[model samples]
Each structure stands twice: as structure tokens, then as C-alpha cells.
Target chain A: MTAALSTGPITAEEWGIVSLSLRVSAVSVLGAAPLGFGVAWLLARGRFAGLVVLDALVHLPLVLPPVVVGWLLLLGFGAQGPAGRLLADWGVTLMFRWTGAALASAVMAFPLMVRAMRLSIEAVDHKLEAAARTLGASRARVFATITLPLAMPGVLAGLVLGFARSLGEFGATITFVSNIPGETQTLPLAIYAALQTPDGEQAASRLALIAVGLSLAALVTSEALSRRMGANVHGL
Target chain B: MGFDIDVFLQRGGGQIVARFSSGAALTALSGPSGSGKTSLLDMVAGLVRPDAGRIAVDGKVLFDSAAGVDLPPHKRHCGYVFQDYRLFPHRHVEANLLYGWQLAAPRDRWISLSEVCELLGIGHLLRRMPGALSGGEKQRVAIGRALLSGARFLLMDEPLSSLDALRRAEIMVLIERIRDDLGLPILYVSHDRNEVTRLAGQIVHLGAAHGVAFATDMSQGEQGKACA
Candidate 1:
């Protein structure tokens, strides 16, 4: 293993890709968590028209090819798209930018976050919310005091999983934003680029190891956090 | 004395229609399970809106289909305890107790954490999570949580069903103490005749074809049985 690692030293350029990947994925997860939680809560607990449709729509990013998701993003948020034009007028640009890359990653990871949160929200006993209501708590207060806290384990798990998934996202990010160096070229993109160039295998191999390590670390941390939260909640 | 409710509601394939006026310092609603007991309590607490009727608490029209006045549950200052003891599992006993306290308007505040905890005998369990508690302990915490929430009235739905006979007996004594000390009107729901006898001063028997009546006698366990 040492020899294998030594065969491909992590260079400054490769390190930049690793750092950028972490930063982008982190931004994506942060952006998606609350939205994911809200969507998940609606899917899990909300009773309304088109609930199943909304649920299915949210899960679409999970099953559809990542490249298709990328394509859709391109059509909707590219520089010439309606949303992109509006954003552009405000001096905001997403196409082929890091923000677009993050957005793409968030879309790819959203289903994982929502799925985790939805299960947890459903698991929360509504009776407790009723009890809070009877105690004079408003709906918002009850959500803050009872529902959110009860579903915290799932929320935390979703966040970490989303981060990991975002970090590994390649197809959607590349398709939506394109792999521009230092801006949108994340770890996987960098590795792929490195592999295509002659005598660049060593650098690509090093980046790949770092990506694997980061993902494993994230998974382990998520598991530990969720276990602790689960224990705390179940003990109640 | 601030609230009075008189209405009828359909529940569980049977219409649990109740028409009574308790001028609110302490209104005791007692009845059997599936007897429209809990539903009556819910209506009074504003959790259940009658299909079509008028309900007023504290002389305030809480629900009136004709007047189009229907206040939501949060705005209604009624504390409710479910039969299953719906305590917040994610929160410690203290946080659970404080939940309603945080929601109350300052002027209407009634019970404090210490008083509620002491009354329910849950002072020691304040730092513990809900799962660590026994059935009896959970009920006590649930009761404390409701009491500290600053509600003007209390609604309990079979609050002792989960406990063993011994724990039930013990908690029953505590319930009496809370009722007597707080002087808060309680809409207590239970299937146990003994509970009604030991606790409620004025009872409303549901499922009886006649309507609401003042069940002033508790010694007539056999009569309460035959009436069923």
C-alpha cells in the first residue's frame, strides 16, 4: 500500500482539486439540507393534493441518469436560459461556474438527503405534536420543539450522505457547468482529465485515493453521529 | 371561570354530542372510552372543531359556524394530555416541560416548572430523556409538561392506562393533588370507573341515549356498570 501510494504523490495541483471538491460539496450540502428537510417533512407528514407526485419528483434525481439531470440543469440555468438570463441581469452567473457545479452536485445528492429525512420525520410520533398543540404551542413552535428534534438523527445522516454524494458527483457537475480548471474542475474531473493525458496516470491515481479516503471518512462520521442520535432519541 | 362549551361532534361511527356549560375555573368531563369522551375534551380544547355547532370558552366564541369564528388550537389556552402520554422523546424532561411555557402569553402564565415537577413527582427525571423513564415516569413527565405550559384548563385522556395497577394507584393520588391544588378545570377521559369515582367531582357520561348528566355519586360502581 505504501509503495502504491508512493507511486503517485499528491502534487500541489492535485491538492487544489481535493480542496475544491471538499469546498463545493460542503456548499452544496449546506444549501440542500433545509430544503431537503422541508421537502422530506412534506413528503412524510404532509397531507395534501399532489403529495405523491411531489415525492416522486424529488426522487427523480436519484434514479435518472446523472447526465440527464445535468442536461436539464443546462437547459434551465445556462447563460441563455430564462433563469440564467434573469440571474445574469443581476450580475450572477451560474453556467460553467463553480456555483453551477455546486448546484449540480446538490441536485444529485438531494434525493439521498430527502429520503433519510422523510423516513425520520415519518417515524416521529404525531401524537407528540398533538400533545404540544394541546399545551398551547403554535404549529411552528411544535415543529421546532418536537418534530425537528425527533427527526435530528435522520437530518444529520442526510446531511453527511449528501455531502459525500456531492463530493463524488461527476457526470451532473461536468454536464451542467463543464470542467473548467480551478473553478468547476472538482477532484473526479481533475482525475479524469489527468488520466486522458499521457504520463498523467500517477497524478490521477493519487487524486483517486484522496477521494476514496474522504468518502470513507464521511460515511464513518455519519454512522457515528446517527447512532448516537438514535440512541438518545430511543432512550426517550 | 372563563370558558363554557356546549356542542355535539361525531366520533368513531357514533356521534359524541355534548352540550354543557362549565364557567371555567374547573370543568370536569368524565366518561368511558369510545363514549365520545376524548372527542368532547378535544372540542373544548379547540383541537376538534365540531362538524356544525357553537363552542365558547371564557365567554369567548371559540367556534361558531354561523359567526365564522373558529380559533385554532394554539390560540386556545387549554392543556391536553393524551392517553398514551405523548412526551417529546428527543427532549429531556425539563425541555419538554418548558415547551408550552415558552408559548404562553406572559399574563396568562399559571404553573411553573418547579411546581409542576414537584406536583407530578418528576423533579428527578428532568435531565433524563423520555426513553429512560418507566411508564409511570413518562406519565408524570407528560402531566408536568402539560401543566407547565400555562394553559388555563387541563384535558387528560386516559392518562394512567399504560401504568401497572400499583403505578396507576400512585399516580391517581398525584392527579388528585394536582386537581385540588391547581383548582384548574380538567376534562378527564377514562374507561376506568374507579378513576372517575376517585377523581371527578361532576361527571358527564357519554354513549348514554339520554344526554349529559351530573354523576355526583361515586359509590355506585355497580350502577355505573349496569348503566353501560
Candidate 2:
């Protein structure tokens, strides 16, 4: 609060962190989309047993400390853990790697994505899906042609929220993957590291500005896309 | 040679049992509100399960609780035109027409998209969304969608009830022409006496105390008297 925001340029390392943040967040959102859609569909349409428990579990990451989520992930997916060892044998790794950061970000961002998608999926008219059925369209076909199209706006908004969450992710990522310079470090991590040094405020302030700018851009794009897609579906 | 149905189900407080068979060119299910008319149609279309009953369309068993065979709605091959049209708002008119046709087997494909559009007089509305169309236009598109699916039978539930008087008359004429040209048997459901008198070749009446009544050889005058 005391110092004015820095208008100085970023160093090459800072640029690397920004690029890494985008990549990690992008990968997280892209990888999580299909799974997110599945969870959302289940929550929106499924009436099976333990549904409440499943929903609560999905949102656990949001309420829990990010470090706790990171630790749980590590316990289940660490190098020597059951899943982690299996993956390591296959030459795939998650612990302390960039992939782990993405995974952690994905977990942290999952609830918001699912909530947005669920709302959209629920908004779709069951009658339209029934109509598709009478036309010989199967459940899967009906979802593709009717339910998904009507829910496009929600899906986009979910993706935007997830992407922003992934970018801003720090605690889970740092705890899960550690703050390595070129590997697991992202924009948030970079900012945190910068704030530690006495004269590193300038770099931290610049990175903070980039984060704010990226988030604002994502929100604006999502808003515009949602409105346009909603209008198109509504035929307005 | 035609559709056979013996549907019995409970809804809310009362029981609904409808039994009928008709090979006629156009059969009508006419009843007042709360008469389970739409429920009967939904059972035939495989959208609702008829407890302890059987339904067959052209000798093909679509549902049979005794035999443990209940085909899903997609496999019923019964074209349904809902009262509200239920067209996909996201798709254009052409896509709506093609939706069912695309799911049809190659050998089962007989009606073309342009053919149905031309028949319905919706050729120029191909690129238009459903919301942009008039009530008559939407009804035509819905009919076209059902017909292109190569459905063995058609079940129309108050298809013209949403249209104004002028649009209703116009669409009825279109329906008559399509019925004459295709000669496919239709199960038309409506409470409107005029629509029944104009279109029905057979009548299936359901009521609270009457249960279900089936009458064939329906002439214009007979239908008018029956609905009266």
C-alpha cells in the first residue's frame, strides 16, 4: 500500500514465468474440460445414491487450504505412492514437475468449472431432448445435438473461470510441485518469490499487473461469448 | 397391419387405461383435458411405460411387459409432433428436418429433406431458426422432421392447437395434403371437435367413467356427431 505500482518492464525470467503460467493454466483447463463436463452432467442429471457426497467431495478443494489439497494429491500421486509409481514406471511423472502443477491447478479449479457447466446443462429443456429421442436420436446423440448446444454459453464461462483459477493458483501448485525456476514456477510463484527480496517489489508489482490484466481479459471474453452464444441459442 | 396398444398406468390419483387398434389412414384420439390423451400417445411413442400392457406398431412389438421387451423411445420408430413443436432452437429449419433423417438406416431412407420441405411449403424457411418462424411454419417444420425419420407411424398431439384460427386452417390443409400424398397412418390427438371431424378415419375416446371406446368407419358426419 505504501509503494506505488511499478511501471518497469519484466526480465527474461519474469517473461518465462508468465509464459509458463499461461501454458500450465491452458493445459489444466483443456485436460479438465471433459472430466468436468462428466461430473457436471452427473450432478445435474444423476439421481444415483451418494450424489451429495460426490458433489461435496468435488468442492472440497475450494474450501480446504490449497496446501492441504496439494498434500493430499502428493500422498495419492507421489513418486512412491501407488498411482505415482505406476505412472513413473510408464515414464510419466507428476510429483514436483510442471505436470503436477497443472494437475494441482486443475483440481483447484474443478469445482467452479463443474458448477458453471451444471447450471447450463440444467437450463437445457428436457422436452427438446425428448423430441430428439422420438426422431431416433439416442441419449448420446440428443446430448450432442440439443443439450450441449443449448449449454454452450455455460461451458465457455466455466472454461474461463477454470482458466483464471489455474493462472492464479499458487499454494497447491507450489506445495505439490515445489518452486523450481524453470519447471514448476508460474506467475503467482514468481510474484511470491519477488516479494521475498527487499528490492524485488518492482518485479512482483509488474507480475501482479499482468495477472490482473490476464484475468480481466478472460472475464471480458467469457462475458461477451456467453452473451453472444446465449443470444444465438435464444434466437435474439 | 396397424398399431395395437393396451396401455394401463396410474398418474397422480387416477388410473389411465387405453386400448385401441386402427389400420385406418388417420385415427384420432379425441378427449377433454385430464383424459390422459397425451399419456396414451406417449405410451405408443415409447416415451412412457404402460404398466402391465403391450404395444405393437405394424406387427413389431415396441413394448410388452409380459415378454420383458420394452424398446426405448429412439427405437420405437414412432414420429411424434408435440403440441409445442419442440424443434431445436439452435438448429436451422433445414437441420431440424434432417435431424431424424440422418439417424435413419440407409435402406430405411426414402423421404429426402427437400421433399418434406417442399411438401410442407417450408422450402424457403430452410435457413430460418424456429423462433423466427410463424406458428404454421413451425408446425410444418415439426411435421417434416417427423416424416423424414422414416417412422412407421406418426403420433401428433394437438399439433394445431397453438396456431390461430387462420393459421390452423392453413396447416390443416397442409396436413390433409401430406396425409393424402403419403398415406401413412397417423394417430392424431386433439380435443378440438373440428380437427377430429376434418381428419379422423377412426376414433378412440377415453373418459373418466367410460374408460376407453373404439369406433371405426368414421365419416365426416359420424365424427361430428360422435364429438358432439
Q: Which is the leading candidate under DockQ?
A: 2
What is each predicted model's overall lDDT from 0 to 1? 0.77, 0.84
lDDT of 2 at A227: 83
Model 2 RMSD in angstroms: 3.6
Give stretches of model 1 more than 4 Å off: A1-9, B1-4, B11-14, B21-32, B56-61, B208-228
What is the total number of backbone clashes in candidate 1? 8
Candidate 2 lDDT (Cα, 0 to 1)? 0.84
Candidates, DockQ: 0.62, 0.65
Model 2: DockQ vs. true structure: 0.65
How far is B87's C-alpha from truth in model 1 (Å)? Answer: 1.9
- Backbone clashes counted, model 2: 0
| Candidate 2 off by > 4 Å | A1-10, B209-228
